[model samples]
Target chain A: MGRQVPIVDYLVLDDGPPHLVAGRCRGCGALYFDRRNGCARCFGTDFERVPLATEGTVRSFTIVHRAAPGVPVPYASAIVGLDGGGLVKANVVHTPADPEHVGLGMRVRLTTFPAGHDREGTEAVAFGFEPA
Target chain B: MDATGTVAPSDATAGDEVWVLGAAMTRFGRYPDQDLIDLGAAAANAALADGGVSMADIDVLGAGNLYEAGSGVGQRLQKQIGQTGIPVYNVANACATGATAIRCVYMAIKAGEADMGLAVGFEKMGKMGLLGAKPPSGEAEAFEPSGRYGSVMSVEGRLGTTLMPGVFAQAGMEYAYENGGVGFEQFAKVAEKNHRNSTLNPLAQYRKEFSLDEIMGAPMMAYPNTVLMCCPTGDGGAAVVLVSGERLRSLSDEQQARAVRIGASVMTSDPWTEGDQVQPDVNTLTRQAASRAYEISGVDPSDLDLVELHDCFATAELIHYDNLGLCAPGEAGKFIEEGGPERDGPTPVNVSGGLISKGHPLGATGVANVYEVTTHLRGEAGDRQIPGARVGLTHVIGLGSACCVHVLEKANA
Candidate 1:
């Protein structure tokens, strides 16, 4: 998990890091990490540069037994509360451990994993959370 | 607000006394390892024990679970607690599964269907996944890109992040910017507060307390919404015991004192035609339910002492504060900042740490709320109890953006 990438922040993504994007609000001076074409605060359309936090709190979490097309199967996911008031819903990295350990208020950090190879021979990446 | 113009036949203090002769619950939170039927059985036992009733005393069992498929839930629960030949049913109303279960019980006893009845709800939400929605009841299902649906829609209803944390992040950022740009620190405060309250709850899904630094440092799923703002799925169960007036006579002082009356129960679905909030008509359900309850119980919100609202998301909880008439309209951000529903406030919402702090188990959440109210009413709620709580109410709405409200009055009152 250690190849240097051209991310905005060494620990964070620049814009769309496969599973991440930046959202900016025009009506309000609020900037978001997830891509929001319309500003949630004031419904503004303009946006600027932003990167996501690498770490956050586990507001809530769960494991998925069923897998859909895009997400990994038999994996864990959490609703992470970032350090900057931003909330992101992503899968947890570790799997099949005690569900009790992944609970509300638990610390988690964001990292990327291979989403699998796309049909076009391109490597796909997605975000997930790990025990911090 | 259009009043139903409906008046009750009986005035307050003129109706027959209704008491909770039985109450029980399985511990709240994730329990993927245990069979749901086992959990339901445990709760049923606790409730029957609380009511001091024999298996023969349980004439009817009203059951609910959000997720449809569970291994041996129906049989396992009945096998552990009740004898064969008891009605073990499943009720699903998205999030209001528990409320509907209790309401059904109230109706059974009031109709003289049974001297004593049990309403039990349990959920293994993680087993069902999030778009665990649109009950595969074989109805025509439409997949829209936007997540907001259900309830009353207004022509002017603007769509927020329908994916949840997305909509709420917009709200949180708006609130922060509205207040001169507060940052993640403010959001952390919320997570910190709710987690602290949860620590005191013995049955809470999470018992650990988090610090501001820890909350702020969490992952960011949505802008302005960090890991701290979301309530992921969990597994849990909740149960309640109901009895006619005749059964309360022989209950121990502990059970007798906890005999709270179910003054009112109401429910309504979402009106998606209008362009108001996610469901502009959604609040109508709560209001209607509360109105009917107040009429039946003779206690208005003003006379009520505590409450538990569905706080699926932090912003949702904030919006509900104003929507429920706990405060003026569109003033929820101010309400939270001012300590309106804080532990020491006039009315404390989510005293059981709410879905935000306790982890939402969907099907069981409705029943879970009632259990907390009952505990607080009985003065048995250890660290999270409201001091001398006499009157309490609970509200829950589901995927249809339906609203279900229940009002309870203390035995002495």
Candidate 2:
């Protein structure tokens, strides 16, 4: 059997529990997920790897019924404000894609599911926020 | 000293001013036959002809094109128009490319580097669906789970998209969530007004008027934004010629009478903000540019007789009403509902049908906006004219994010 792997480098799979990682600025305590050259807030050259919060509230979202071909539709793409700190853009999963179901200020927690495996039989796990 | 702390060119003391000598735009719609250079040369020559000037009179050329920026469009356009060894600036600032191109020429004339300059923005995007980041080219690379963007399959349905409609849909929704009294109907009205206004704009891409009910009933591209509300991707080009104040006096009385003074030209990028990281902050940079333009021109928002703002989507237009200081904070919903932006309303906006009905050819939009405002300021905008319009504003914002605002005034005003 092939090993399971996180979809993005920021998503820590082998860690104690599946959690996302961020670059916390040493200068002004700003956090970023993607690889950043330096802290935009304080321009600090140094950054400390920090674990990001799993639960958050939906700050804003859009129910995308149309997308590029082969990409699934009727998904609630959202921006979530993590409980402690940090904001991320992700899709709201495990919930109906509608304002009645997913909306602003809706509480959600990070969750992972297996995406299609590669030719090598390695399973790529992706993260999304499901209703908490 | 200005905001940048650089010793300013004391406008009051220097008596230096830049004026739009002439402006013109080709009809905005699909043109499968015309190449970028052909469209660019046409607009450039038409603007020069309108200004009663020729390429020999131009000192600099600022060409605005998004997709073909690397091809030195300005130089290529010169080959078709005239081969003058003037400095050419090829610019691509997302949707603001056209506005930025005009700014380059405006600044050059203001800085005394050139007495007269030409700026043209053009794009040949034919029926591109849903503007977003283009997928990678060439054969598909094997998905490495720990690669830069991670496995392509894993990122799917995980990371949100940067599609224009969705970005604007969320932006509009956020505005409604923060400020009450906005919904699908309110957003649809924005499209309806623009489409109705298009009926009067002969050069518009789509001149047929659509009722509010019809707009609301159209196919939805994203939540709240329907196919009718979104600006269509098309091919078009626009251009302008700028002259220094000193050069204006040397021209004929008719030429001088047609000149529109460039009261203010300001471009701004997004300042750091917490919310900007998650959602595109189309507001802050716009507000900053608007305020700065007002300050430079000494013309308040209340003084604006007309406006041509970027309405790539109907939802974008609503929020920009507040961002452009056309209405009080949290009053944009009421502004449209009260018909404040209608053709006969207090502040007529997008009178040239805007990007919604006029068509949004990314590179051409900015200069086309300027062309619309100049047309009105010159009292030459037939049929859709705002009577005795003397002061006008043109604004355009690009998503990577840059915002450009310009205040234009009638020469005599």
Candidate 3:
């Protein structure tokens, strides 16, 4: 257990720090994460490597109840519009328990958690939201 | 030809009618405790009551359910509620399920297939987890490219809530840069406005009050859409009762006055031969539907004092504010900056807080629009009522593929 690194995470670590990832369209200026069948903005098929935005504002949010097994209960999630002009919904963290204070349009940004720490320590890392 | 010129089906040679004698809805939310069968029967019973007729009078039963388990819900409702030998027909069309059911019953009556018909939309939203919100991949099991992913949320559905918030963030940022100084706070003002109006509506899922700063500080779902911009999922059902022309007018003035006339109702499925730009198709549908309703009812868009549009997203509502011709196209965003449509604007849309505030129960949402429109026309939308609302319209676009627009008037004839 002396600083063991998963093969996938170790491989990606050489590429960049902060380890954020997104897909940028080649044909159009559209941006997406995960793989896209086609570009939603300009219907462009080509995409390039692009860094994910670090900051944004909260658009909407909700608190989840009855969590799945191995996950924390009463998790906070939100829609964050990034500084680069796009939106992403993720779990909210380092914020108040009540959603009233989370508020819409307030400045927010991206956050990441320890890989494999979530649920039985899988190699997958996750993102959370914080006050910008 | 453009979308507005399309002709309406000529079912009436004048004096023919499809009268809404009854309507009902299941309480909207997660039905962890309720069964679909019970909910459907209850809604059908409520509709029968609203129509002043018993289930015995129903000649046809049309059930609209979005979940796979509810495929045969209409027959179950007919069996439980004991309809009068009515042939039960199940209708499915994604978010437009209810509208399809209503249209089917109306067309069946117009064609003389049934004397009276029942249209019901029931949803057990939390039962199978989420009924929709699936991937856009063609290979996925639930992928029905022809299906609707709700009217507004279709674009950002599978992408999770992030990209949606991002677009809103861009719009909000641009709005601030364009205007002197306004940002999320401005969006918060609109949320505050709707939440304030929602307190008076008992049917609303979220009746709690929220302040400007409070909503402004809420967690963002996508950057511009805080939790307030989005609608909650609720378990609810709505039913409509329709009958032929003669049986409707025989009632007293008080009874006759409650009749919500269906002037011209048209459902259009867009041809996918073109690209995915839905703005033109929607605009075309609205114009043509409005035109036909105007011709049939002899009233135009300028004459309507109220409207209950499909405001699934703030962006959709903002875009539609112009597309619906409430004002010029590009100026739809100005209404938020200004005090327009504040439940007292020149022609208020969604005075009942719409899907955003009132809640969207998927299968029941289309019928819910009808309920709000009918209430406004009947002068019964208590705190959010549009005073002197005589003629109105309820237009709901399902996913991007189809749009169902109905032109309504107060009187049957």
Candidate 4:
């Protein structure tokens, strides 16, 4: 099989269930999906690699009917509070893009799907949350 | 009597009084044929005439413009409106560009750097679409990984791209989810009120009024935000003339009468964190800036005669009413429902129809608000005038998230 690539640098594609990577502040335990220079809360530079939980709860969501050129419309965007720690914004998949259907406090699990191709035509993968 | 009976021979301090001698704005709408400099020059010339002064009297130029005309915009503006080779500075703080330019001149005059200054803001939003994110460069790269760049590179950012309306719609959704379920109807009420207010403002882009039902039934761009609730992208410019108190004495009595004292001007930026709630996302910055303005002006929210605030979206106006301390938290929707922010209400807001109806020209918006407030304070607002208006406030929040608040009082009041 050809090698697969993750769309963003923070996602880890390995054996077993794929996990999202994050930086955890050693001082205040604040988690960030991206690399950190210092903790905004404790102002500490010490950080450690931590994998984010796949399950999370939707804090809020919106059905974006309009978007940039080439991006599909009427997709549901959400702020998901991770069960492990940290918060992330992602698209909701396998769920109808309706207010009544996708709602706050809804349980969801992280899942990866084929996004598009890179310059070399290798298949790239993107992550999102789906109704648990 | 020390020659003039006024306090004399005092050393100039940073706290020295500053006055807005004049303010003017082009009617905010699309001007496909006009360039940004032309818009800036027209507003600047009108402001100079309104202040009863000529370009030769302006000691410096502070200009604000968002995009397109890259560097040396101030110099270009001066070239268009008679360049006296005065020192010129260009300021760009996204939507708060105009207000930031005003603050720059205010600081200069306050520090006695110059007795008279001209601040102008112009922008031509050529097209309305999603704002693409550019890669961070140089020093910005060090901090970019931890900031918005991180969010933009995340899985969420890749799944769906957001424009201005989407961002505000998310905030509105979060507000409803957090609060006891504020709905689209309340948001529609805000659009209805501002569109109605625009009917009286000749400079407003959308002068036709829309009923709440019509606004609610309008095309939905995002959940809870209809087409009517969003400010249209347009091109325009606004200018303000600032003079020191000592310099004010040299102007004609009629010019002095038209002046409005810049009691306080404060600007602040976002202290955002990952996963922080977004409804009151701008509250911390706005509160910090507005509190300082109120303290400096010695004016409370209840003491204001009128207010002109940034309403880029209908929901933004609702949230700003709380952010500016005009109402208690969770009371913004109720305040609107009771007609508390009408032209005749206890604290009139957006008496110039706000960005929703007046059109948002990015760099020009902040100064355009100043123009509206000055007209009201001078009792020269014609039919849109707030009766006995003595003090007014202008608040603007730009999205890389900066907030600017200015308090103005009738010069002699």
The candidate maximizing DockQ is 2
* Candidate lDDT (C-alpha), each: 0.62, 0.86, 0.61, 0.80
Write model 1 residue lDDT over B305-387, tens digit each, in one string: 68888777665566556556676555656566677787787778787877878877777888888888887877888888899
Query: Model 4 residue B412 lDDT?
Result: 48
Residue lDDT tens for model 4, B260-285: 88878999887656644223355678
lDDT of model 4 at residue A84?
Answer: 67
Pick by TM-score: which candidate is best? 2
**C-alpha displacement of A90 in model 3, angstroms?**
18
Query: In CAPRI terms, where does candidate 2 land?
Result: medium
Where does the lowest 10-residue lDDT sum fall in candidate 3 chain B?
B144-153
Better of 1 and 2 by TM-score: 2
Tens digit per residue, CA lDDT, model 4, A17-95: 9778778889878776555678867899999988888999887777777655445667888878889677777788887
Candidate 2 lDDT score at position B102: 95
Error of 3 at A114 (Å): 20
DockQ (C-alpha based) per candidate is: 0.03, 0.51, 0.06, 0.34
Highest-scoring model, lDDT: 2
Q: Which stretches of candidate 4 lie over 4 Å from their true place?
A: A119-121, B1-15, B130-157, B276-280
Cα lDDT tens digits for candidate 2, B296-319:
988889888899999998989999
Kindly report the interface RMSD of candidate 1, rounded to 1 decimal: 14.0
Which is the better candidate, 2 or 4, if ranked by DockQ?
2
